[model samples]
Target: MTDATLAQLDALPTDELRDRAFALARQRRDIKFFWDLFTHVTHSDDNTQDGWIGSLDASIDDAVALWREVTGHHYGDAEPLVRAAFIDYIMQHGK
Candidate 1:
């Protein structure tokens, strides 16, 4: 991608950044991207306390939260690194 394209992508709103990266992942059947997203979300904070890893329901909830985040329906704003992850993924794969 050109520098201008990169600039444009960087210039997008955080929600739009998430949307574009997510749409690209779905369109390409990129399971790795989704996995990466899941990992990023789950690991964003110290959510591993109190047997967080042992519950399938918790995992599902996290997945749903991730979906909401990507769809711009999340209750809270994403973290800086999570937002950077979206931009970095698009920079690497959207080119």
Candidate 2:
């Protein structure tokens, strides 16, 4: 995702974010990578960092929502569990 796209996404409401993400996920090979990076699952490098954060820089609200779905826990509510899962995903994927 480009900073421009992230800015566009950040401007959307949570629901719209989810809908757009899912819809794009279906067609985008890198959507999951972006989602993981945004949610802090994987290490973000220059190739993925700037745009990974957001077009205009933004909050993790939408990322948190996606995290909940991916882990079945409230966003950042279970700190250790969330961190563990985030790290585990990255480790398994070798990203």
Candidate 3:
């Protein structure tokens, strides 16, 4: 992802970040893509113990950006609003 995109996202507060992330997750198949990439990245980071929302803004940004780049071309038929709610669930309750 471009620095500008990251910068734009990073500029938001946590609540807004949550809102944006949930909105982005509303994109078709976004949750599948995010979790697919997240699972892979987490496995790759197995040497380290990481948790939700990441430890740093850059790290979280990088992960999201990378996931987008890697799997953005394919989105399942999931409805925008549904996955967005899922993202909100993850943001609110995921470990």
Candidate 4:
């Protein structure tokens, strides 16, 4: 990622970061793909549903910009996988 991208991501709140990640993942894959992945990962598990929406509000733009840099592609091509991975990780790890 570029310095500017890293700076942007570093400035974002955790929740926003997560959101951007999820959005990117969704872009990479289809809704069904991400949904299935999420369901499979969270099955039989207690996943936290709070705080995520607000964690990265401050840095959403930067996070998204940084995400593009990290993936070397625009959101349309990379978001789904990024989002899915973020969701999967958070669902399994509570963060």
Candidate 5:
């Protein structure tokens, strides 16, 4: 990505940046983007639990919470890397 593009994306709020990338991914039906998103969210710090909740209902809630946490920019220290990846993806495919 060009410096100008990077600068422009960086200027956006994290939530906005993520939303744009996600919207583009959805529009293009980009499996790789979704896969990467799943990987990132699952590998995030809070998801290191060894045991499953066992209940499908709880699991669904947990999944929803995880998505909200990450997309809401509450990803803690990983926020910068996540934002950068979103920016890079947008630069690469947002034409």
Candidate 6:
């Protein structure tokens, strides 16, 4: 997502965030499943996994920044599980 899009999403109400999260989660899950299947079929090594981690870390930074901007709360005290899940999704599926 673009920074503008992320900001728009962040500006949404809490209920909208929940709904958007659900939609994003479904997309993330589908992508992860397909990526896993492809990797299994190709018998790829896990050595390339760091790329995904790096992408996910970038995503986490964006998310944390958005959360802080919208909610006026430090990212450190934000919901850890949600942050972790987002990171996990990116790590598993990001290109």
Q: What TM-score goes with each of the models?
A: 0.58, 0.29, 0.29, 0.30, 0.66, 0.27
TM-score of 3: 0.29
Q: Candidate 5, residues 43-88: lDDT per residue as tens digits? A: 7556544443223444333544545664565767677778888888
The residue-by-residue lDDT of candidate 3 on 1-95, one tens digit each, is: 12334345444554454445544555433545455445543453454334642434444345566545543523244323334533444544433
Task: Give the Å shift of residue 21 in candidate 5.
Answer: 0.3
Cα lDDT tens digits, model 6, 1-95, are: 32334345445554445344435545554444323322332234365343442343344335434334443432233334344444444434433
**Better model by TM-score: candidate 3 vs candidate 5:** 5
Backbone clash pairs in model 2 (N, Cα, C under 3 Å; residues 3+ apart or in different chains), count: 3
Q: In model 5, where do residues sit more than 4 Å from their true spots? A: 1-4, 44-66, 69-72
lDDT of 4 by residue, 1-95 (tens): 22324445545555565665556544554344334433443333354233332344435344445334433443343345444555444443332
Off by over 4 Å in 3: 1-19, 22-37, 40-58, 77-85, 90-95
What's the CA error at residue 2 for candidate 3, in Å?
28
Best by TM-score: 5
TM accuracy, model 1: 0.58
Which 10 successive residues of model 4 have the least lDDT summed? 47-56
- Computed on alpha carbons, the lDDT of every model, listed in order, comes to 0.61, 0.42, 0.45, 0.44, 0.66, 0.40
Give the winner by lDDT: 2 or 4.
Answer: 4
- Indicate the residue-level lDDT of 44 in model 2: 26
Q: In model 2, which regions exceed 4 Å deviation? A: 1-8, 31-69, 77-95
Provide the lDDT at 6 for model 5.
Answer: 77
lDDT (Cα, tens digit) per residue for candidate 1, span 1-95: 33426677778888788777777676666656666565555554464334534445444336445557543544245456667877887887774
Q: Which scores higher on TM-score, 1 or 2?
A: 1
